[model samples]
Target: MPTTARVVVLEGDFGVCAIQELELPDPGPHQAVLEIYAAGIEHGQLQQVEEPQPLPVIPGREGTARVLEVGSEVTRCKVDDVVLITPWSADPGREPELPLVEFDDGTETEVAPAGSWGTNLILDEQFVVPIPNLMDKEGASVLGNTTLFAASAVRTAGVGEGDSAAVFGCAGVGLSTIAAAAAAGAGTIIAVARDDERLEAATASGATETLNLSSAAAVERIAELVPGGVDHLFDCVYEFETASRPGRTPVRDGGSALVVGLPGTEERQDDLDA
Candidate 1:
């Protein structure tokens, strides 16, 4: 059975998008049809526009939605269930009926991952997280991508119970990392950022402590608090300008520092050399 879905399309480069309607066809046996409530924009959405790709991409990567329908054999959710949509598709091996959407102009073409429209799209159950019905839709939407990235980083860093960890940046990924670390039962979670608002967000996200880098020697302050240094450090601001900073050095001798973030390369060599 086919259903109507609304989507925001970016006909060309830039983040600007236009809303349109599409006819969604029957979902795969393991898929569910999602009616989006809210979607969050990610950095990759903007960056991808510059790379070569087909035009008219659906721009949302993650979002909050309600299950309008489910295909046979789908057990994770049922109609009317609130959920979060993540870009990770657990089963991409199966040939999708998608790219199945027909544009309003009566044209049809393939849509890439960028076309993983949360506004209204058929999604795999594995990519959907069942959320509390009472949870704020906007917050749940933003958390999808953040949690996805944070979870992987935390897992890769091997954070453990009672371990001390510090996260720098305190924005989307940073805040989410703090939350993920806390969820992993980290003993002390330190959040370092330049803004008060972000630091506050980090605390709410589960940071046991917070620091504003502009006010003090962040590394020194962190070392003083953790004594032997934190067990792990997530340097979210690992860019050219801040690359050589001691932000990543506050880890203990055997501890790990996970450096992340996009950066310009021209000055990276010179800065790291200093």
Candidate 2:
């Protein structure tokens, strides 16, 4: 018997479609079959489409799953272990960041052994991070990537006690940035967004000040709260006109603007003007 699964495929230029009947091989040594639960949509997928790669590709970067089957050599998981699938599975001896999975398929897929964007996926045991006992499925779906990005942004901004910081978005990643910033001991944390609900969430997460930009003068409002300007500006809503333009303006003369959002080429070029 063969296993068929449904997956999202990018056929060609700006083309994304759902198709079933994907052929998946059974677990081989060091591999496992995953039953995917939730996947996060990141900007990498969109960029890959616009830039163009080989044909007939899947387009998700991260997800959580349950181990459905394990290869003979796989000892990390059994038939029902819950795990978070990082896009790339690295060599076991090396840390998770340096993934070593390779394929002769000659496609520039983000994951070393490809990825988990479908109802079912075959993954190497090394790529699967066990979901913590406390973390729910949604939490596990984004923990690894979200944690890495937050840590990277915080380090890039040099956040520390007595430093003032501002985050220009309140999406999941943006909220993660806020929590990381607060935990890093940033004296004043400001969050700006058009969503009142998200702003409230950011405040609860760690933001000392929340500004609703839904009306106007959003930057001015942020500036009023920061006074001398923030020590670090973390812009996650870099495409929105109001949020994008405020990063440079909100930073003190020597302060730095760390862009965490993924912007397109044109928008990035516009950032040069800042």
Candidate 3:
């Protein structure tokens, strides 16, 4: 049976979006149907719709929902279980192979539209992670992707007990990196941002120190504080020429520099050499 679903659709590359009714298929043997509670409209989704791409696609990547129906073979979750819907899985290295959608016009698309801004969703059991019963639905929805990226960056940097780390950008990912570093037992955590207000928020989120990137002596100051430099440097902004260059120096010689943000088209070996 097909269920009536209300979904937000991206109509074109000019940022046009619309709400329309569609028929969602019932869950398969390894799938589950969920009543979506919250979905985050992230910047990446916005960029997707704004940039050139196939039109009439759904745009969203993270959300939370309550399971309403489970397929016969599904054992990971049951009815009424609140779960986080994310594009990511336990394995970060591999991409998910989602089933394709066949439109009524005989056109087929291979992308997974499960995260579409819809009232309900039919997703594979593997993409939905069960959350604690008491967890806030909205928070769990938005935290899934950003938290995974931040946590992975921290782990890749080898932050451990008594280690020190510095996070740049102070955006969602940067702030999360700071908190993750603190939780990982980093002895010192430095948050860097161009804005004063974001720096304050980073401090509240467990940053032992905050640096205003706008300051002319910001890099020098960071070097002075950490002496030889921190154990890890997380570049969340990825402004390689300006930010990552100076940012790299604050990392101890053997420490890793993790770039979390997207880089520009221009290639520069000098940036990586830092």
What is the alpha-carbon lDDT of model 1 when measured against the actual structure? 0.75
Candidate ordering by lDDT (highest first)? 3, 1, 2
| Best-fitting candidate, scored by TM-score | 3
**Displacement of the residue 118 alpha carbon in candidate 3, Å:** 1.4
Q: Give the TM-score of candidate 3.
A: 0.88
TM-score of each: 0.83, 0.74, 0.88
Which parts of model 1 have CA positions greater than 4 angstroms off? Answer: 48-52, 90-98, 104-107, 113-119, 240-248, 260-274
Colliding residue pairs in candidate 2 = none
| Model 2 clashing-pair count | 0
Query: What's model 2's TM-score?
Result: 0.74
Predictions ranked by TM-score, top down?
A: 3, 1, 2
In candidate 3, position 117 carries an lDDT of 79
Give all candidates' CA lDDT scores: 0.75, 0.71, 0.76
**Candidate 1 C-alpha lDDT tens digits along 87-170:** 666566855444456666666766544244545778768778889999999878877776777887898899999999988788
The per-prediction CA RMSD against the true structure, in angstroms, equals 3.2, 4.8, 2.8
Q: After superposition, how far is residue 227 of candidate 1 from its true place, in Å?
A: 3.4
